[model samples]
Target: MSITVNPDWWKTLFDEVYLMTDARSVCNEDITRLEVDVICELLPIRSQSKILDLCGGHGRHSLELCARGFSCCTLLDYSQVLIDYAKARAAECNLSIEAVQSDARSTGFPDESFDHVLIMGNSLGYIKGPADSQIMSEAFRLLRPGGWFLVDVTDKSAIKRDFNPEAWHEINDDTVVCRKREIKGDTIHAREMVLNKQKGLIRDQTYAIRLYGSQTLASLLEAAGFQQVTVRTGFSPHASKGNYGFMNNRMLATGRKM
Candidate 1:
């Protein structure tokens, strides 16, 4: 007899190998620190503000925010392995954070539970269909009145301007990853292969992310009942540089629940 696996690639893609690849990617501690600083400056955070790090893989930003004196920090992600890793790291650092394994599309938290919601690390566009809209709606629901929501994603504009079909990079001395990409009707399909000296060829996985322009994303946020939607390009801690137009490979969008 033959068995079939679930079609949800995200379920399997976030395993150990995925974590290793991510560690080598833009998801390192230094980047997390810079992102946290930018978030702190943009949002009206207080000592008692409840912050939800939505889709926060491994609680990097959550832990950093907690260390910076934001006490009530909750890190939520769909991957149990990542949640466990975040919990271990939080314990090791003697920091207290609520780490929950939950889907970003429909988080079970109560309405208006958070004072601020952060969706970072190009995590917004992963879901296949109207699910992205649902994610935005859920973020709107989770925030209190006047709460802030921040989202960071790859700049579709820049990607279109300079499309690279294939790229390879060394994550470490012993491991390298190659990515082949193709854009098909608003979705960027990607195939990734990880090569390791000891393990040989680790694995190959394919995934798709729906691309969005600044106006499209801002409209989505507005449709979800967000106000003061601001879209910016590039990642910078400085407000002036961060709010500039789409000139870099990454983009950021922030809104307020009013």
Candidate 2:
């Protein structure tokens, strides 16, 4: 078996093209509101709850939570660009949110400080090797007793079953992005190319992400001292009832620190 090396492409990819490609899906006001509402239904959030948005790119979730009357919100992401953008947005909106640029594996926050933690947008597989476990451990350490930890990730089983080699998306009227994927062992290698009307070909990047099945992820969470772990599938708003199996494309994993 070959070892997986972390090139840490996220440090660069998230600067411009990433925002251009995903802004509509992640930063839209209506979508953010719906996602926040779903989270509210799943977690016991209160006005005074101290929530930490782990790996919260751009702080959309944190902003929505604060708008919903949750005063204590901290948004943490490794991308300084995204963090700075989120801070500016928060400042413009006159919302008091703490934005921190830090690695998720070691957040450096005090133990048992937050009431709830969120890791969304499938940001769990960025680090290689045992780092996933360390990320979970950090989440456990940051949450107080009875605190909820919510995670969203792509369903690896489904992706493996229906692996597509190439896909393309129109980022904007004049920009397009294409992605080609290859699965080697437990890691998925993605090569992304971006084309712009003005600049022609702009970016060509490659990255690797480890794929985790439901059982594997649950085991990691449990080993990290999280109890009552539950893994559900198909969290999209348009997903039908009972769309929560290996065939589903997305998974939502929840656990409580006790």
Candidate 3:
């Protein structure tokens, strides 16, 4: 019998220490660091504001916020490995942050628990199940009136124009990478793959993620009672796309719960 490895298995092999005091230094992985800076620019954070980093793998953002003096910073994700790494980082930094292993679709928390709920870094696409809409709805449920949620994903238009099987690349013996784009009815599909090579092929896996464009994301958030929803196309001032769904840098999505 042969076993098939997965893309998400890299986290299992690597020491995913995501949430340490020095997380920023650890996360200077170019793209990830750029994402962190962009979100901080968009958020109206204050010393007393409370924030929840949903699907906050390794608590990097949460820890950063905590360091910035947010009243309460919470990191929630279903990945225990990621959480453990985050916790280790928090301990080293001696920061008082809360990290929870919980599902984004159902946090089992009380209503209106956070002021700013963040689900970025393409986490929105990982929940490929019947409960995806439920996750968004539940995120809305966890917010108080006027709460904000920021989500990030690939631009559907970009993916449609540039996606292909040839987008994949192999970096080294320990890394095999690929990118793909597909469309399934109303939803657009974009994925990133990375493989870790072992002695032969025992160490191989892929990290696949999907994304929804502005229209679908806006409609879903609005249907869930989020008002004054705004789209940031990353390249525009005010983080607004000005009725144009096309832009660059990285997708910066911002919405408010009415």
Candidate 4:
């Protein structure tokens, strides 16, 4: 089937079904711990640092950080459902985390308000064109001098090496999701369909992600006024179940405000 990518698909794509479909990776505690470990190792952070989790759906990483004694952590995402879910989880767990529902491109935060900013879970490249730069600029604006900005994304090399056109997975006994992918220039256009045993076709959507090489990402970061940009590949979430999707092989692109 031919599918046209929607620029605003993400506005509704991260609902409850998304959590169910990506449960193994996004909701997995073990994998979250491992990813948090990598984040801590890659950046110089103290327990009291003020961190911003950009596009942080349901604030998984932020919650984990709070558990680890990182006191001031704020999560921002465009989805109201995810933000509310994160807030409830934080209250239930007695973890102190601030969750905000807002666009990543222009978060209404004061200048230099964060010690570090993170874009995790392969959340970048959601829209085509220069959106990445706008997000990075916001991250730059939020970070204090000497603050670090880290991005977790699928490695372009890995995707080129193992590009699968189609895949399917059983979410459970009642539901299944099928995916079809096509590469156009630097972007991967995808169509996802979710079906239930009794409900028939529940969800069908198309989205696009612009893949970036390490050098290209670094240059973008530099253009956003970040310096000392570095990229580390081979950083996998090591998820135990569900489709890895774009998280199959990941890279960390980090930069400094100064």
Predicted structure with the largest lDDT when compared to the true one: 4
Off by over 4 Å in 4: 239-243
lDDT values for all models: 0.81, 0.83, 0.63, 0.90
TM-score of the candidate numbered 3?
0.74
Clashing pairs in 1: none
TM-score of each: 0.90, 0.91, 0.74, 0.96
Ranking by lDDT: 4, 2, 1, 3
Instruction: Compose the digit string of candidate 2's lDDT tens values, residues 1-258.
Output: 333334777677777567776665675677678778978988999999999999999999999999989999999999999999999999999999999999999998999999999997778776666888999999999999999999888788877877877777787799987877888977788777899999998888887887778999899889999999999875664344322222136678899998
TM-score of 1: 0.90
Cα distance off (Å), candidate 4, residue 96: 1.3
Give the total clashing residue pairs for model 1.
0
Q: Write the per-residue lDDT of candidate 1 for residues 35-65, one digit (tens) a residue.
A: 7888887899998999999998888899999
Give the lowest summed-lDDT range of ten residues in model 4: 235-244
Tens digits of lDDT, candidate 4, 134-242: 9999999999999999999999888877888898888899999999998888888899999999999998988988898888888989999999999988877774433
Q: Looking at model 3, which ten-residue stretch has the lowest summed lDDT?
A: 237-246
Best by TM-score: 4
Which candidate, 1 or 3, would have the higher lDDT against the true structure? Answer: 1
